[model samples]
Target: MIKEKKVSSRFIYFFGAFGGILFGYDIGVMTGALPFLQQDWNIENAAVIGWITSSIMLGAIIGGALAGQLSDRLGRRKMILIAAVIFVIGSILSGIAPPNGHYFLIAARIFLGMAVGAASALVPAYMSEMAPAHLRGRLSGINQTMIVSGMLLSYIVDYLLSGLPATMAWRLMLTMAAVPALILFFGVLKLPESPRFLIKNNKLDEARRVLSYLRPKETLESEINQIQEAAEQEKLASQNTSWGSLLSSKYRYLLIAGVGVAAFQQFQGANAIFYYIPMIVENATGTAASTALMWPIIQGIILVLGSLLFLVIADKFKRRTLLTLGGTVMGLSFILPAILQKVIPDANPMMIVVFLSIYVAFYSFTWAPLTWVIIGEIFPLMIRGRASGVASSFNWIGSFLVGLMFPIMIATISQEAVFAIFGVICLLGVAFVRIRVPETRGYTLEEIESMEESRQAKQKSALLERAGL
Candidate 1:
């Protein structure tokens, strides 16, 4: 038997999930900083402002793809370290951009977005691989909790800094992301590599040592055997580990479910509410910018509180069931306000805020966290990194389009119409979950993979029988 230092499970969970904090902070910080930046730069063009806001997502698209491939080669922990370094660099550059440097700021945010995208892809896989199957959903769900907490932190920071000089306030808000990035960097240095990754790399002794600490003593050997078997099967069956292999019949369903869940989560437009809530509130209620800014804090609070609730139900509930219910409620929340406006013709503007709160409440506990949870659980180990990158890229693509277009869409169409469109997408998301996604709750990663094989075998047997073979 090989010996290794035992790492704290709590520390592993906290730091493994900590990347979400930076991801959430960068995303939320811009919401508060955008108005100040636009004013200080004397920028009146909505499209230009939209580009500045959405540019990080464009970079995230690249970051997810790059990190996914790199992590598969370098290990998940190393990729996270690289991402933290990039986040620090990006945050500092964003803070120091000179006057009328909107282009520079956009470039910096795009650079920062690369880190955010990498974290978005890396954290779920890391947490999933580290966690016991029984606790994987809740353990993976911790990343979501950290994300909302970071957003809440950013909103609070924005409020505290808003009273400063416009130039100084936004800079501080943007640079604050570096603080957590540094923390994550230091903490991750001591984290053990994922046992599953170790097994795949032919580091069986290291895998066993890591698993000894991660799994119960009585079951540790059995767990090691399961992972070792899975790794061997994958090595034998997969001749090519390229991205193209994901398109084969064996993996096609997993890809559709993984990528579709990821894509739809953003397409439903939660970030539109997050990135632009202040603007949306100001437009609807005719409130001063300062008062409008307070709304995000409220939304942030609801999000954090709701995310806490998910830690309770994550393992107990079926993935598809929570998704279906949350999507239904979210769809109705958006659609109801539109209908109320049409019927009443002058519904209380605060009614829009109330509906948005409801939407956030449902989303925080449901789709927001569960998307990562399901994606983390569903993919096979051989392609988990590349497939996750593909899913994360699709997610960021939707987020980028939604972030860039919400302003433009609202300008050309009625706000009511735009929200109505999001409502329709949310309902469509529910249908997608019901028809395409599988239930992976209460199953080990090895068991889930085997379930897929059994499913494909049944389908093949049925077809052969029908042909009288």
Candidate 2:
């Protein structure tokens, strides 16, 4: 037996979760840079502005789909390196994009977005594969923490660099992504290929080698065998089912629940509310939007704090309990504003801000991070990659539509009414979780897969009886 090594799991886990930093940086950097870019280019079209801001999400949708399939075929490590390289190239290209070359910048942002999407999908799964059963939730939760930290980093950089000449200001902000990208590329080179991937490819000895480092010596052999058996079962399951079966009744309900939650999370307009917060505050408070300038930093802090709370409590509580509680609170936060607006027509706009702040804190503690945690561990191993991609795609689609439509939505309907709609969506989110979603917080991925398969078998039996087949 190979001797057990005492490596800092922290180093491995942090490197694995490093991709989240890139994801968050790309997301937050644009928020600050967009204003300068608009002034420099003298752009007046709202559609153009929206396109520039949302191109990343659009690229993410395409990237999520491609990364899912590629990670499965090419291996997780290779795909991560590929994403880092793409981030570097996209950042350099975007920073140097010439004045009046909006299309070029959009393309580069989309290119960077591809990396963001891939990282978003890959990090959770990759971290999930390497983490011990007891630590999985915390490790996966760390990925979210990294993402939030990156956003805060970008926000700080943007505020500090605001005094620079506008031309150079945004360029530096856009190109700053290359720093983390390079770090990620070099860092991943030192990590092992996922042991699960090695097992799936029939590299048994190599899988053992990886697990020897990943697991304690005492549990190493058993862990390898457990993963190996899971891989074999997945292969057999894949052989027995075609992709078409997923589209058919065999897996329809599973897809509906997974993909539905994914989409609903985004569609409830969290991002819309966030992206337009300054404007929203302006309307409510009857004050200059600049008064809210310090607020993004505040919100970013909340996001970071919320993610930290998740890391601490992730393994401690029941997933459904926290989710249900968070959803109910998030719904009420928005709905109460509408009720107040109707009841007290002249209610102070600061009240709206207060409720929104509450919403943000609750969201940080619940839906924002948990959405990723659930999707990361919930899918069966056989189609985990593809199904994750689908759910991710659904998420980006919701993001894209909401980003593109929210301004129009506000114009067509008053902002209060628009927020009311989001409130209703929140309640619906609660129903999905309470009734349809399963709890998988403490279970191993293989065990979760087995449980889902057993559930599917029962569903099939019920369908056959109902059809008299």
TM-score of 1: 0.88
Clashing pairs in 1: none
Per lDDT, the best of the predicted structures is 1
- Note the Cα lDDT for every prediction shown: 0.87, 0.79
**TM-score, prediction 2:** 0.86
RMSD of 1: 3.7
Q: On residues 309-427, what C-alpha lDDT tens digit does candidate 2 reach at each position?
A: 88788768888888888888888988899899999998787787788777888888788878777877777665665576678788999888777677667657777888878888988
Question: With candidate 2 superimposed using the best TM-score fit, by how many Å does residue 268's alpha carbon deviate from the native?
Answer: 1.3
Candidate 1 C-alpha lDDT tens digits along 14-100: 887678887888889988888787667877677887898999999998888788678879999999999999999999999999998
Q: Estimate each model's TM-score.
A: 0.88, 0.86
